[model samples]
Structure formats: C-alpha cells, structure tokens
Target chain A: MSLLSNSAVEKNMDLAPAPLKKEKVKMKKGLQLFLIALPFLILVFVFSYLPLYGWSYAFFNFRPGIPLSQSEFVGFQWFKSIISNPTQTAEVMRVMKNTLAISALGVITSVLPVTFAIFLTEIKASWYKRIVQVLTTLPNFISWVLVYSVAFAIFSTNNGLLNHVLTDLGIIDTGVNYLASDNHTWLSMCMWNVWKTLGWSAIMYLAAITNIDPELYEAAKVDGAGRFRRIWHITVPGLMSTYFVLLLLQIANFINNGMEQYYVFQNAINKDHIEVLDLYVYNIGMLGTNFSFATAISMLKSIVSVFLLFFANKMSKILRGESII
Target chain B: MAESILIKKKTKKEKENSRSTKGEIVFNFFNMAFFALITFICIFPFYYLFVNTISNNDLSSRGMVIFLPKGIHFTNYLQVLRLEGLGRAAIISLSRTLIGTILTVFGCALLGFIFTQKQMWGRKFWYRFVVITMYFNAGIIPWFIIMMNLKLTNNFLAYILPAVIQPFFVILVKTYIESIPAAIQESAELDGAGTMTVFFKIIMPLSKPILATITVFAAVNQWNSFIDTLFLMTDSKLYTLQFVLYRYMNQLSSLANIIRGSQGGSSISASIANMQTPTSVRMTVSMIIITPIILVYPIFQRFFVKGIIMGAVKG
Candidate 1:
C-alpha cells in the first residue's frame, strides 16, 4: 500500500505541470472568447432581454419620456379594458379571424404547389426541370408591393386587364370592381400571398427531395410501376418527414400573418377582410399611439405564440417521434 | 421468413394487377393538364408585367393590352428614369443593401465563431440567450423606442444598426461553424495562433459557402425591406427603392398629372378632375425596383441551396 501511494504521488507530481499549462491555455482561450462575444452579449441584453422587462408596461399606462418605475401600475387594467370594451373586443376578434383565414388559405395553396414542384424536379428532362424551377422561383424574389401592383393592373375596375379582356370579348357589360368588393378582397390577398410564397416554400421541399435516395426509384421501376404510381408510393413517403417538420414550424406562426403585406394591400374598402392582428398592433401602437394597450396586445401575442410553438413541438413528438424545439 | 414469403406473394399479386391501359391514359391526361395549369398560373404574372411595361401607355390606358404588347414603347422607362426621386432612391437603396449585408455577415460570423468555441465559459448560456431572442421580441414599438433613445431615428444608422446583428443570422452562422471539423482548430492552436487568428485564417475560409449564402440572404432582405424605412426614415431623401416604389404606388395618380402637365393639357383641378392612375406606371415601377435584385439572384442561388441543405441536414 505504501509503495502504491509513493508511485501515485510521483505520477501526480509529473502530471501537475502539464495540467497547469492546459489550465492557463484554457483560461486564455476563455478570455479571448469572452472578449469576442462581449459585443453580442451586450446587444442581446440591451435589445432583446431588456425590452422583456418592458412587458411590465402592459400593466401600466405607459407613456414616452417617463421613467418606468414612476409610472402608475394598475394590474390587469389593459386586459380588463380589452375585455370590457365591446367595440374593441369585436375588432380584435374580427382581426384574429381574418388573420387565421388568410394564413389557412395561404398554407393550403402553398403546400400543394410546393410538393408538386419538388416532385416535378425528379422528372427525367433536366433542362425543362431547370427552366421550370428558375421561372417558378423568380416570383419569390419580387416584393409584395410589386405583386400588389400587378394585381392592381389586372383587376382595376376602370382599366384592368380582366375588365378590358371581358369587355373586348363582350363577356361582360360593365367593369368589375374587384379590389373594392369585400367578398373578393380576402381571396385576392390569399392569391397574392400564395404567388409570392409558393416557390420559396418549394425550395425547402425540393432540397428535401434531393436528399432522397435514388435507389428507391430504381427499385420501384423494376417492379413495373408507372410514374404516378411510383410518385404516390415513393416520392410522397420520402417527403413525409420534411413535410411534417415544415408544417409544424409553420403552425407555430399561425397568429403571425405578415404585417407588411397586409398593411400595404389594406384599403378602407377591404379593411374588414385585411386587418389582421399584426396590422392591428401596428395601427394601434404606431398610428394611434396607444402604447400601453398595444404593448398589452403584443405581450398577449408573445405568450400565445410561445404556447403554440410548445404545443406544436409536443404534437410533432407525439405524431412523428421528432420535435423542432 | 414467413413475413418475407408473404411480402413476395403480395408483390407478385400487385405486379399482376399493375400496368392497366386505362390507368396509364388517365394518369397521362391528368398529369399534362395539371402541369400546364400550374405552370400557367405561376408564369402568367411575369408575362403580364413584361407585356404591360413595354406596351404603349395609351393602349394600357384604354385597357387594350392584356397578355401581349400592343406596341413596344421605351418611353415609360425613360419617363421613370427622368422622375425626380428615381436616381437618388436607387442609389440610396443600393448602397444601403451593400453596406448593411457586409456588416451583418461579418459581425454574425465573428460572433458565431466566438460562441462555438468549447473553451468559452457560459457558452450554453449565451446560446440560449440568443435563441430566446429568436422566439420573443419586444415587438417593433419597443425596438423603435430603443432606436430613438440611441438617436438613430432618421440617420442611415437607424436603417443599418438595427439590422446589423439579426438573431437568425447568428444562429445560422453558429450552425455552419459547428459543422466544421475540430482538427483544424487543434492544428491552429498548436501553431500558437490566437482565437481571432484561427477564426479569420482557418475557420472563415472553410465557411465561404455559408458566408456567401448569408450575404445573399441579408442583401435580399435588406433590399426588399421597406418597413424599417417606414418606421425609421422620415426623410424622403433616405427612402430605399421599395419605399419609393410604395410611395409611387400610393400616389399613382400624381404621375398622370405630371405627364398631362408636360403634354400642355389644360391644367386639371386637383380636387375635381379624375386623373389617370398610371396602372402601367405602377407595374413599371415594380419592375424597376426588383430588377437589380433579380439580376443578382442567380449568383447567390447556388450558395443558398448548398448552404441551406447542408445546414438543415447537419442541424
């Protein structure tokens, strides 16, 4: 036992010098990394984390140019106000409905086109596939403002392309006011959203499809399966994982219909169908200068989005044995 | 062995039932129709925009041209170029996108490298900190407040600074960095190279594909962005291309007034006269705004696909 202890001491003494050197090197590396990360840490704290404290402003009647501590805090006052006010409450619900409807339409229209594009890329004609891919994706780069303008050109009552073509062909006696009609507004918004997004969304699925093994297709061919049969059996099953992942991620943003596209397209004529939650927040916060109420709504949105994300992640695990979060 | 025998029997039965003539015909017919329909819907808008841009203003005004050009006219393009704010707005937008993208990519890359180092203390804490920011933000109002407090409201810094270090870009860069092999770092350390030296010399070079992808993504995002300008920029002089185009879209009728005035027509009363809305002009403006970005897209598309696929698979 004494002999073993003497050898252990000798070994410890021999190894101590190298470990000390390693510790010094690690400390140096840590210091350098901290220095490098200092600015980012400061930025995250100031911009992201600090404003989280401002969630407290939802309880207060927040005003600019006043210290937050000095502001009067009335617990749940904004939430109570939102609930008690019938007109405001109706507007909120209306906007929420509009947001969901638009997003649902967008998701439905986008999914098939995206899936088709991914499948189409697997076709034999390489050049044709490339052209189709390029042409399809070109629109994704175009801004919503541009898309709205194109829609305006086509659907304008006075001089729109559709009105002109219909009138020229003697199909209609009068021009159609497509933009002003509330019934058509939501559909128009959905069409525009799908047009801008379908190709971009397809890119993700296309990447997923490319990752699929080519040997599966050969095996299906050897079984004397036709193209459509093979696509149904093989291509779709291959894309299932990616489809689920993207679908879950997208569902997490169910409440966040884009603000800019809606805001730009929205007119008083189409306000009923187009005033989504993001725009509602923008109008109330930026335009109306109702800072506290807007903050309260924003806080509510954050909570809801977080819950949705968690729920979606959990559901993904339940359904697919994988979750993004 | 029993399951394999059953599977083989099932395959033989399926093969005997497959390859029906009616099924092939029906499949071909529907496939062709669906393909044509999808392609038409996707491609028609670009054709519409192109035809409208080149068609004579009068033909467009009369709503004569729909699918094809009545007469090719470059006059609108010339007129757009001659517009007062066009050149300046283009320049402002171009410079802002270029500068903004460069700063954002480098900053995110540097931060990503630092965060990925295993020796860094509290690395997990910082990673969580950044990721949490991705999920929750104080909304645009508080961000605007921060910008105001920093006195960045109207200056170009307002546009650039707020967007310089996006949480998404940082995450993407970190993911890309993590995929790089650790052996390179070990060699650099043996050479007595510091973290910065290793990052700039070894790590960044290996990350060219991702860096290029980030550049394109950031550039396109910055170029297409108008909301930032809407909130931060009060000055018309500082307007980006998209914002300027939006202004024209909102005030489209004013272009007709300018054109009519140039044509020596009777001065139309501002309130009563129904001015031509320049529907084609709006289309032309849209094209003008997006043309630069579209022209540059193919260069980035290659990097974008590779980088995203690699990142997604690795993640």
Candidate 2:
C-alpha cells in the first residue's frame, strides 16, 4: 500500500525540478493541490468521519435534548445489554436470523443475473434484445416504495393479479395472502430483489462478455466448437473474475442488508421475518428513543462489517491476485 | 480498445457467415424461449400495473382484471394527480433532483479533475478520503444522531448537500478524465491557464459523456431516496413524493385491515372502497412515481451503461 501510494504521487505530477529547487517547487505544488482538494476533503470528513466519532455514544446513556457530556458514561453497559437481557438477546437473534436468511438467498441467486446476461447476449434479434434490456433495467431506477406497490398489485390477497389468475384457473377457491404470509419471507424477498436488480446487475456481466478476447471465440469456431462450447469455455471464464470480485464484495457486505426494501415490504404479520440488522437499529432507536443502546448495537455491526471487508479484501488478493481495497 | 472492438465485430460477422448445424438450431430455439420467458417475467408486473390501473374499479377490487384492462379509465391517474400535497411533494422531489444532481456532478467533476492532476499535493490522500466512506460508515443509529446533531433535519440542504461529496462518483469521474490525453491539460497549463480554468473550460467540455452519466445516477438517487426523508423530515411541508407515497400506502393498508377486522367478508370490500386511495389509484400512484424514469431511461441509458462499464472494469 505504501509503495502504491508513493508511486501514485510520483506519477501524478508532471513537473521534475532540479535538486536545488526541488523541495521549494514540490511544496508550492502541494499547497496548490491541497487548496483545490480542501472543500471536498472537509465535506467528507464531516459526513463520514464525524459519524464515526458519534459512535462514541455507544459508551454513554445518551438521551435526546441532553448533551453527551452531561449524560452518564457507562462503558460496556449497552453492549452487555444486547446479550445479557433476554428480550434484547431474542430481538437481536431474531434480527440476525432474518438478516442471514435474506443474505443467503441473495448470494444463492447471484448466479441468475450472470445467466441472464449470457442468455441475453445470444439473442439474434437486436430490437427485441434492446426492448428487453431497457424494460428490465427500468425497475432498477425506481424506489423500493414503488416496487412494493407493484408487488402488492400482483400479490395482494383481495385484488392481486396472481391470485386472480390462479382462482380463475380453478387453482384455489380464494386468494392466497402471499404478501401477508411470513412463511416464505426469505423466498419472497429474494424473488423481489432479483426482479428489481437482475437487469442492472446483468449489465456488468454483459459488459465483461463484450470485452472477451474475440480471437478465442474465432479459434474455437474454427475447431468446430458450437455456441454453447464457446460460451462455457470462453465467456464464462471471462466473467469469472468479474463475478468473483462482485461476490467477494457481497460477502464483505453480508451483514449490511439495507433497510429500504424490507422496510417498505414489512407488514405487522411479516415484520418478524422482514426486519434485518439495520432496520432493527432504526426501529429500536426510534421505538423508545433509546439512542445510546441502539448506537451500541449499530457500533458492533459496523465493526464486524469493516473487519469482514478487510478479510474479504485479503482473500480476494490472495485468491484472485487482485484487491478491491 | 477500438481496434479490438472492430476485430470482435469482424469475427462476429465471420461467424454469421457459416450455416448453422441442427444442434445449433435447437440451441438457438431453447435460448430464445428462455430469454422470452425471462423478458416476460421482467415486464409483466409493469404491464399488469398499467392495465389494472386503467381497468374498471369494481372488477379490479374483486381481483378479476387479471390479463387485460376491463375498461380504460383515466380517472385514477387524474384523481391521483389532484391528490392533496401531491403537487407540493412533487415540487420537493423535482427541485431536489435538479439541485442535487447539479451540485454532485459538478463537485465530482471538479474533484475528479483535481485528483488526476499530479501537481496537486497529497492527491492520493484526498482521493482515498472519500472512497473509504463508500465502504465504511458508523451505520444507521449513530449516523442518524450525527445528522440530528448537525441540525440537517427538516432542512432542504439535507437533501442537496451530502450528494456533492460522493466519493465513488468522484473516482469514476477521475477515471474518465484520466483517459483524456494528458497533453490537452498540459498544453493548457503551458498556455498560462490556471487549474480552475483548465477544468471548467477544457475538462468539463470533453467530459460531457461522463458528466451526463453521473448526473443521471445522482438524479435517480436523489429522486428515489425516501429513507432520508423518512428519517430526517418531521415536517410534512418537506415531504418528497416517495415519502408521501410510503405514508399513504401504510395508511391505506392499516385502515383496510381495521375495517376488515371489524366488518368482515363482503363489507370489507365496501370499507376498502370507501378508503381515500382505491386499488386503481394506488396502482396509478406507482405509475406516476415511475413514469418519468421509464420515459427518459432510454435516452440516458447509453450513458448509464457507458458509466457503469467504465467505472466497474477500471476499478
């Protein structure tokens, strides 16, 4: 890392000064660059690092409208409470269960997007391919709230189209409350997630496919290889590096299941199955205005996530000979 | 890179020259069928939403309008368009997207240009300063407290400020600017142009494709973001369109559940019918929310695709 940063510094500047004035000119350039970079630097410090400083609230009995300096400093109390109290432990466990279930489903289905991209590339008709690509990618740009609306429209008990079609075909006597049911929470979330992000994620793989060395395909063709053979031997291997990079990043983010989609999809009946680690923090923090306690758990999650990220970065470096960080 | 692409095109044309064997024909048939199924699955929900939103109210309520529209009615959209606070919510959403995208794209472009300039002292430190934020944060509760402490709550600046410092985007913009020949900027500098002048007068014009790409990303992010509004905005006057939709959906569903619990059976449908937002209008709300994106996505898609590939592969 030190070597890379040093080389970066050397490569960035075009000017090479004589030894007599090297330090003076370098200092002048550094000052100029620092001025140019200052505004964004301060913005990032306030937004990113300041919140990290706020994590100190984990050690206090923080209350709103009361300054942290005035609050009682109780080191390890909130962290212990996450495990010592039965209710807190159960809540934390339940949140962890949902988080793991959803993430596992997400990781399992990651292959679908890659497969989708491969199949998409094989389409002979250009117009149909374009239409499909555009339509599929549209949902990715919409909010989770809008996606929930579509989900409810298709899966709502009394008026959902899925239930309507099923009933009309004599599949059932009445509508199935799939949206309200907690039995398939993991399955439903995975399906919705795939439906929403498949096209957007597939674009990465498609771009990778477009970047494959064409000589390999041409040579394979000359060797009497079929399309499937070319795809399996060449295209798939070309995509593996990209796939593994993304997959490692995903693993690093295993505990960071974002709250928005699950937040919108949540109902009273399904809340038990829907709430993940981040949502639980939001819920508990807002539930009784227990800021410090919630921050403690949030702090723990953030630490674990960072540790996982570094571990994953190391693994990728060792295994793939490439490091993301 | 251009030559490689040209080679790929020629090779593809060469491959198309040969007659397809029977096995290849079968494979193509299956491939088409698979993709057709996948495409239908992707597009069906929006089609269903649009048809049902335009269908007759009673049939839709009874879950009968499955395949197509029973009656084409524009009333739902008209009513939704006229809903109270909707115009205000839309103004909030629009202004935020516009202002946020402009600031973010500009900041990123400027910082991106700066990062690539070796003459800038400590450029690596400044570049990594923001990218680290992309992977690490204090998580939700502490971040919320920080936002609260900063007094960004219920403030318009809350919506517009944070986006301007997006590190990933700055990195993306920097990668793109780096692709432009160094001589262009070097020559400008030699001509006595300052860094600011070179960035605004030269780099900005040449980086239009990438700027457009990041603009779309920032705009979409700003437009679709609701979690910020949900957490930060206590004042209804500050609500964005998506936040309003969320509250409305929760309200309707909870109200429907209460009426169903009390009245039961067919009367449940009656109470739901009496609700402020009907099924058709709810679907219309979904359509309203996504229509702008759907309308302009194709025009901006090439840039989006270009940006993603450029950033992802290079990163």
> What's each prediction's TM-score?
0.86, 0.88
Candidate 2 local lDDT, B1-315, one digit each (tens): 999999999998667655465556787788877777877887788888888777777767777666778866666665565566777999999999999998898888888888888867767777777788989998887777878889999999989877788877888888888888776775666567877889899999999999989989999999999999988999989999998778766787653443334343332233333333457656777788888888888899999899888878656
* Minimal lDDT window, size 10, model 2 chain A: A3-12
Model 1: CA > 4 A from native:
A1-17, A62-73, A118-122, A221-226, B1-33, B67-71, B253-277
Q: What is candidate 1's local distance difference test score? A: 0.75
Over the stretch A74-111, how does candidate 2's per-residue lDDT look in tens digits?
99999998889999999999999999989999999999
Candidate with top DockQ is 2
Residues forming the 10-long window of minimal summed lDDT in candidate 1 chain B: B268-277
> Which 10-residue window in model 2 chain B sums to the lowest lDDT?
B267-276
Question: How displaced is residue A160 in candidate 1, in Å?
Answer: 2.0
Candidate 1 lDDT for residue A240? 83
Interface RMSD for model 2 amounts to: 5.5
Per-residue lDDT of A113-152 in model 1, one digit per residue for the tens? Answer: 6567655764555766666666666677777777767777
Top TM-score hit: 2
